[model samples]
Target: MLKKLFLVAAAAALFSGCANVMPTGGGSASDAADVAAAAERLRIAMVDPTRPALSTLVADELSYGHSGGKVDTKESFIADLLDGKSDFVTITITEQTVKVVDARTAIVRHALAADTNDSGKPGKVALKILGVWQKQGGDWKLLARQAVRAS
Candidate 1:
């Protein structure tokens, strides 16, 4: 009788584990749309100097390299913008590509172009930016961003 009881308990535990493994119906088409929208909003915010709220979407510790140089942190990133390090920061996302790599992860590809306006006029600069966004606490936040010069 004890052996039978043990077997029953094991079966119950196994079934319970299987129940938890059932799909939660996450990562649907709507989720993909929402991710794309969020990414575009972030791009808009980054370019619009008046919108401070958009900046929050960016990770506080972002690393970026510009004009064929080394990567830098968020603080330096902001400083660069304010100090006229990047002449014209025009983020043109030719295509907002959202890929749901997992239930809670997405990758957004943004086609971008920038001009260094430190000389008081826009200079020629073009690049493609890829941003990785992670869903955190019901909101999507940018976790990482990288730029590759568009030849």
Candidate 2:
């Protein structure tokens, strides 16, 4: 019985090779476009400061950092955006690049120019932004983001 079990295990291992089990994690053109669309939706949502949109796009474990050396959790980020503390008048992203890392991960980089009315004060910024988007429950959500002042 032991001999038979060993043989069966070996056969199973041989049949279930690494090639059959390893992750094939390349995104198709359509997938890339879809991710881009999600990102666009997120951008529009931020400028609009829509709560549901922000909540939907952002993961619960999000780590959001600003060019001013302040970092915020997902809750705080969304709260500030909704509270008019981070009011955005216009947000324009340029030189955007999206790289799909694996089946569940993607990296996006862009030059962001945002005109804002922060706490009733006008502000404008140019930043080079990097973000990580992860697929969860079949939807891509922002996991982390960092921004640096653009030179």
Candidate 1, residues 36-126: lDDT per residue as tens digits? 6566555444554322544566566566665477686766665655566643466555644667776777776756765446537767667
List the candidate 1 regions with Cα displacement exceeding 4 Å: 1-26, 87-89, 119-121
Clashes (N, CA, C under 3 Å) per candidate: 3, 0
TM-score for all models, in order of appearance: 0.67, 0.81
lDDT of 1 at 135: 76
Measured on C-alpha atoms, candidate 2 has an lDDT of 0.76
Best by TM-score: 2
Among all windows of 10 consecutive residues in model 2, the one with the lowest summed lDDT is: 15-24
Report the CA-based lDDT of candidate 1 relative to the real structure: 0.60
Determine which window of 10 residues in candidate 1 has minimal summed lDDT.
15-24
Each model's lDDT: 0.60, 0.76
Q: What lDDT score goes with residue 3 in model 2?
A: 85
